[model samples]
Target: MTRIKKDFSLPAVFAGFITFLIGISVSSVLVIQAGQVLGANQAQISSWFWALGLSIGLSGLILSWKFKYPVATSWSTAGLALIIATGSGYNLNEAIGAFLICGIMTAVLGFFGIFQRILEFLPQSLTSAMLAGVLLKFGITLFTVMQDQLIYVLVLISTYFVSKKTLPRHSIVITLLACILLTPLFFEYTATKIHYGMTYPVWIQPEFHWSSILGLAIPLLIINMASQYLPGLAMIRSYGYKPHVNQLVSWTGIAQAIFAPFGAFSTNIAAISAAVSLDEQVHQDPAKRYIAGISCGVFYIFMGIFAATLTGLLLSFPREMITTLAAIALFATIGHNISIAFKEDLDRDAALITFLMSASGVQFLGIGSAFWGLVIGFIIYHLMRIQIKKPI
Candidate 1:
């Protein structure tokens, strides 16, 4: 205990907070888009912030504290896609109903231990291609920094390199410090002036519909589990920690169910981007990463309370800043995923199909690029298998 405590300190937790901010910033637009779908008026939009902030905070704290790993939580990107895709067709209540159904399905999947099998069915090649597709755009965006915000971008980039070289553990700290110091100097603060205030969760009642249950619920469950949950489990393992997937998934599902009325959308385990926290807090014993979770939770609750102001603050940042930072942060993973996407000779055809389809950003019946990316990968993979077995 003493050794672990000695390794982790308040400073480390603060570093995690910086990464947490960037992580939320990573996909928050999806959240905002979903909120708009639900007829999220000012207060309700603020409640969207409240729900996500509070959920992330509580979930991050409990899991990170309990497992001694930083278990990041985020609004379900898949769920957001579902709501946006079908939102106009369905009211908020029906969407919530779909969300609730998805949550229950996810919880049941975790409970029955079927999530392990689902990924196996997904084909590793397809999943890799889909992942590569999802992250490729952001990877390009990293270099897109030079187009705008060049000075601060260069400063942050230099800070990032220097911190890695000199401060090692403090690399992200230095990067964040650079962003804060440079924001006012080079960027227009007026662009980012958002209202900061307290917010309480606003509940939206769920109304069940067959269309929502099948169209939104089932697909949402698949995407959330395949893309979000499975990746989250791998994230923990990548950091050399044994993750309790069932416990994490089940708890996240149960919590999501509990919060649906307030437009919580979906809450689930995080990955890829969540890795930033793990890396930033590397020297700290893995178990102590909970402290970072705790800190993140604290910030989450704080933000939820001030959802309006914070939302404004988040909205205030130049769109390019958000896009570039997110894109740059993803550069490393995109390269790695692309390499893996093309790695297997057996899986090559499928992976390429998935990668191309996903990057194409084509919406087939509005299903989104990620879903089709996997679909194309699998189609190619199995089709090749069929071709090889046919009379030759």
Candidate 2:
């Protein structure tokens, strides 16, 4: 604890704060939307915030403290998207049950070291490609929004580039500040009423059905593992962190299971936020970067305590601003992954195929493009290998 205190620095703490803000800004609305789709009332929606914030907060804190790595955790935004799309017929209780099943399955996979093994079998190029593919949508959206909000988007982009040149370490901070200053001019700003109180987690008793398990639970599990967890792990590995992958996975699953009854869908390693925490600007010494994770965890706990207020504030940001922020934050990550994906000559073609497949956003049998990208890439690599081995 003393050592942890000594390692803490203002930049690291700020980085964590920014990371938390990015995480919430990027996806809280989608989570709220998912809650509404499931017919959740106001209290249930608030419980979703409480459960997600507390679970991710505690997980990040515990993992960072134990491993001394910037092990950030976040709710599964993809899972929420899936729920909004496919969980229409399911009641809240059935959705809770599906959430529970997904958590248990995730935990089981982690306990058995399945995910780690799968990662081991994957080539670095393919994984990098997968990550790049996953992030391409955000990049596209950043420019697409410019069609409607031209001046605001231009200002945000200029601010980001200028800040990157002048103060690379605080580029995001500067960009966000610029956006905040400019937001009221371009958009209507309304402050939501803040209800100051401790948010209690509401437990919905699980009611499992075969339909929910097959349709909701399994798909949610697959999406989290392929689209979220895999990319997150790739980011961690790419940044040269040798995390206890199994422990991280297992613990997130455990945390989700514990909080699922409270409307928490799924929690997993955070790819975008984790990248923000790992930035060199956060801490010169990579060894001390765990302090950022700790700081983020502390902030998450605070967010959970005032879930209602924070949710309102997070929702107050306009869609374009949020999307732009997310795009800027992820820009470096996308570039790094793309570079890594095509670095090697032999794997270049396979990696590109994987990247295109992932970016295509194609889904089959309820699984996302990320999984299919990996599969197709692996098959292509093997085919190339077989061709090389055969007589010409």
Task: Identify the leading candidate in terms of TM-score.
Answer: 2
Error of 2 at 274 (Å): 2.8
lDDT of 1 by residue, 15-99 (tens): 4575467656656777878878767776677677787777767877788777877787766665677678778877778887887
The TM-score of predicted model 2 comes to 0.92
Candidate 1: clashing pairs of residues? 192-316, 194-312, 194-313, 195-309, 196-309, 197-306, 198-305, 199-305, 204-261
Candidate 2 C-alpha error for residue 199, in Å: 1.4
lDDT of each: 0.69, 0.86
Regions of candidate 1 where Cα sits further than 4 Å from its true position? 1-7, 10-15, 26-33, 120-133, 191-196, 284-290, 331-360, 363-368, 371-392
lDDT of each residue in 231-282, candidate 2, tens digit only: 7888788877887889999999999999999987998998767777876767
Model 2 backbone overlap count: 0
